[model samples]
Target: MTNKKDENKLIAERRSKLDLMREGGNAYPNDFRRDSLSGQLHQTFDAYKDETLREEHIRVAVSGRMMVKRLMGKASFIKLQDQSGQIQVRVERDSLPEGIYQRFKKWDVGDIVAAQGELFRTQTGELTILADEIRLLTKSLRPLPEKWHGLSDQEMRYRQRYVDLIINESSRNVFQKRSQIVTYMRSFLEAADFLEVETPMLQTTPGGANARPFKSHHNALDMELYLRIAPELNLKRLIVGGFDRVYEINRNFRNEGVSTQHNPEFTMMEAYRTYAEYTDWMDMTETMLHGMVDALNGSTLVSYQGEEFDFGKKFMRMTVEEAIEAYNPEFDMARIRDREYLADYCVKIGVNVQDNYGAGKLQIEIFDATGEAELREPTFITQYPTEVSPLSRKNDDDPFTADRFEFFVAGREIANGFSELNDPEDQASRFRAQVENAKAGDDEAMSYDHDYIRALEYGMPPTAGIGIGIDRLVMLLTNSASIRDVLLFPHMRPESFD
Candidate 1:
């Protein structure tokens, strides 16, 4: 047959099936009264070991999508899966009306149905339902993926997530845990007196973090706007407007590369507190995360990717210089002040260094290459160089370093916090330096916001702020290896229509 003829024939067959269903009744029914769920059935039968037919005589009205069917001439066994679990249904021709039985036989594996039945034990001792009546809830035109092998292709599973959720049990569990983790986090924050607030996702100037922003044009204003890379500046603006404690759990967009750890768009949680420092933020992080671990796992210890991690234990603390020394004792901190020497050392270790960058940038390169992955447990590497941390306050003892800390776990950076730079003059100078870097072809450098500087000129309070990558935290708590595993619908390339 020709391609066009085959297509026309398939369309005609689907129309005929639809017409038959319409004649029987509405194809999709409105009401399905489910009395007991699959999980509830399991709970009710938990104590019944010796299952005689008498104890299993309680009738249940259950509704679910038909997953599997074993049909005989006079009787059939069907599996129904609800949200909680799965239960088997036994339908005999003598039990249901002849017309309904005929319709049940016509039902496919993916069809939704409601069944009124009594519980019973099979010869294999599995708990099942003996159906007295059955009704079709919705007809599924498309066949489900294979039952046993499932949608095994990673790309296909991501692209067609509904099919993946139907066949793959593990995928559903990951998403369920993701929801639970977010709920626990929100409760923990609320209990701690943090007021959750939302800020604009699209902004005129993206000043929060050091990354390229995804730009969009505003047709109404005939101007360009950017999707926020982070919500730090706006949340702090709230702090300046007299909100002492504030947080936002929302999406951030970065026009950058995608990797196992990186996504073009992802969720983040940022919080700011009045009259606090990076040290206080570290303690808060430990407490919040330890509480989550206990709530989720009933203990502070969690095993992720073959390593045992304990969140309740005292987290290791070290300065950036100290971490560098711990990892590479041969390196001298005094020589780190020399830009040429630092640049050569960074190049030797395969660190990217621009010609205009100074010793501070080179030091960050070395830390990323050697120091970050050395951290296996929860640890805070503090006191970053002032040049690289433009928005952080300079250390009182050493003006060259900033009062900043980054939390690392399992060789990845999880959170960044700092005592914010409240000095308007100092902040202006730092912003100027960043502007120079941007002009020199540093696309990832932050833009200097004059309005933010003006807000600081009004004498903003001493404050501390932190941004935690929510997806990464979920990955850690759920023992998921990839960011894509935690995200329900991760970004993907568009498929070709042809």
Candidate 2:
């Protein structure tokens, strides 16, 4: 394909402008003083009528990219957009230097400019600034996306996030809300006596969760490390070290497939508290979510992807068996524990049942395939089978089930919590079982972490711990349909951007 020459011509023109700017003054000047945001100026003066605004002569200095421009013979109307929002600027020929006025006419829509002017109302009742002085702050080399069309291609949006953020109003709002959601969560945890902590992202063994990890090498120590799949194990060690309550909000890496809901790297909030059970975490989860939803939307009700969820209402609670039965009433309940029956059923259903896998694993597989999708409300599924919960304390009355609970909303897991396993001997045995699974070609199985077991020897308190995916939480709160929407720069295939 031949270059339309439009792009090249645009680039060449901007280069000429850059050279001209250097001759006249600095092409990229840093001395411009911006005393106000256009959004705030609008808010402060919007209430004033034309007569009041003109009488008060409210002078303000603002800086932003020129988003819209209409040049007349002796006057021009332009829209300048800053971090806050857009403001209109009206520049008369006599208001600025003759040379500067002529140069401003040639400036492109993407050019950064600073304007000092008096706030006034336009004939159409739109609030605007009558520019007394206008100076080019920075020259934009390339043009932005077409105004009416905007940036709508999803792949392009993720790959070139800066362009997406600049062109799309909703895109910027989503990220702004994402930051707020994280801030709200951190404050909530901090106020609850949870000390914010940081754990090593690089771990000798990724033991926290049964997820495949991305590995790296430490050259100095000649040791291999894995990007932590979850910070669970390290946070628990802090509990053993006498921290009563702790939380970490950071990144976790998993070697996994990408989807609307799945990313190789994601943010999460993991917290642990001493002397608390799985049930306590459940209550706290509900409370925190309720407050956050209110903070974001000013209500207990949250709407995501066309579904309404009542966060303030009491979350539904159920055992794994009860949840499975509720969602799949026709499923044979006896097959959940019948190892041979489940093994044959797994083969018939074309689901890979790992070799020597017990009925407990099969039970979860059944729930995942048939039941998990039906949990659309805030429901807590408790009493997870022991085989799938190595780091969780077993239920006192039932050896086969652990005191674990996963909160779900919109048919996806939102949070997971449990009473932690602290018995050194028991934990060692569980680790051994995982090692066996890993040996048998299960890459997602946890490793037998001797050091973590050694930490358990120091005796972690009766603790409740939970990890909530921050990306998904933002998705729900912002009504963002995909994980990529919340992430500013989601992973994308390498692309040519010229």
Candidate 3:
């Protein structure tokens, strides 16, 4: 690591260079235009021999940041990296205008430059650009981190992401793959005839998910608003308004703790389809994810970290109680639904049992503590408890459980889906129950949204809804271990420069 003193010295040296450029009247030039990218040039001309390239005289212009410099007395080899990739430029003093090569020699690494030249192959058979002209485009004020060592501090990497992206190719590739994953998701949903829409980011009432919301006050209205925790309720309102299939890829805000699996501000894809049951969503999720794995990995298997999840085969579906029993057989299955028994078991197993927790909530708490992480394969844990899933429809035969499933892989939840509770009376009753839970000091309980209840009163068709965490999915696909690794600019504590 470079000490602060040494880093400041380097920045001062670069600043002096900038001062000289400023004296010459053009410290920053922006009119340089390039006709070719490094990757594209290599792709089109790599097959040609040195003699063939020189004979063909394929002229091109490229612009990128200078990454590597090898200066010999009168000639030099410098590598310029563009968005696509890197290319080598050969700068010869004899071939350029008088004094130009001397000026070029002073230009530092990390400086953005534009070069126009004909392509050739080096003696070592590497492709090169025999430049006729080169111009400095932007002067980088601070020197980049050393190339070989790169950015080693994880916290520093996240804090200074711009430098991380410039120095670390792997980091760049992760974000690139993130883009591909989101693009593939959008295309996949669009192909299914789902209409993409936008909902309010700032809401008067935060409905949808059970999470503490980040509050904001609307000064004009003199009313308090909230950054939406999820777009579920608004999307459902569109469903009630007769949109058969709708989806929103949105950012949700929650006043929550951060972890490798959680970000307070995160991206999610929420979709609702009318006349579709939760079971239909299960099928669609399987198909969509299976195809996605094949599209991204060219195989049905995703190797995340050390574990491999198979998407080709049918995703395993297990009930919450069954999973708990499978992972913790010491607990009595017969007493799984008994609130007192489950609460006692929870306390025994180190879960902080709350007094107001119902039987369904107790069962879920037990499952979360024991079973959630053990699900290594692509598995759908179904039949969530009604006490924990206020937005889900109650099962027909079992009133205590809701028609919901949380998709998990490699021990983390990536998606959640459930049948919509279309009955206005049932939804209203559930809202009242949630309000009561809030009154009992459950900070993560949902608020009773009368407008959403009114929307349901107008009669919505049987709908299925799902929210897929785009960040977590990207982490799985890109093999990134932390949620911050996938985010471009993750929230961080303010650092003191002094």
lDDT of candidate 2 over 1-498, digit per residue (tens): 123444687788888988988998778889998999988987787888999999999899999999999998999999999999999999888987777788788899999999998989999999999998998899998788999999998877898799898899999999999999999999999899999999999998886899999999999999999999999989999999999999999999999999999999999899999999999999999899988998889888888888999988899998888876776666677666788887776676667887768988987887787678898988999999999999999999998999999988998998999999989999999999989998888899998888888988888889989999999999988999999999988988776444
Ordered by TM-score, highest first, the candidates read 3, 2, 1
Worst lDDT 10-window in candidate 1:
1-10
Index of the highest-lDDT prediction? 3
Candidate 2 C-alpha RMSD relative to the actual structure: 1.9
> What overall lDDT, based on C-alpha atoms, would model 2 receive against the true structure?
0.90
* RMSD to true structure for each model, in Å: 2.8, 1.9, 1.6
The window of 10 residues in a row where model 3 has the poorest summed lDDT is: 1-10
Write down the lDDT of every candidate, Cα atoms only: 0.87, 0.90, 0.92
- Taking all chains together, each candidate's TM-score versus the true structure is 0.93, 0.96, 0.98
Q: Candidate 1 or 3, higher TM-score?
A: 3
Per-residue error at 195 for model 2, in Å? 0.4
Candidate 3, residues 187-296: lDDT per residue as tens digits?
98899899999999999989899999999999989999999999999999999888899999989998999888788899999999988888899999999989888998
Return model 3's CA RMSD, one decimal: 1.6
Candidate 3 residues lying further than 4 Å off, grouped into runs, are 1-7
Q: lDDT of model 2 at residue 452?
A: 86
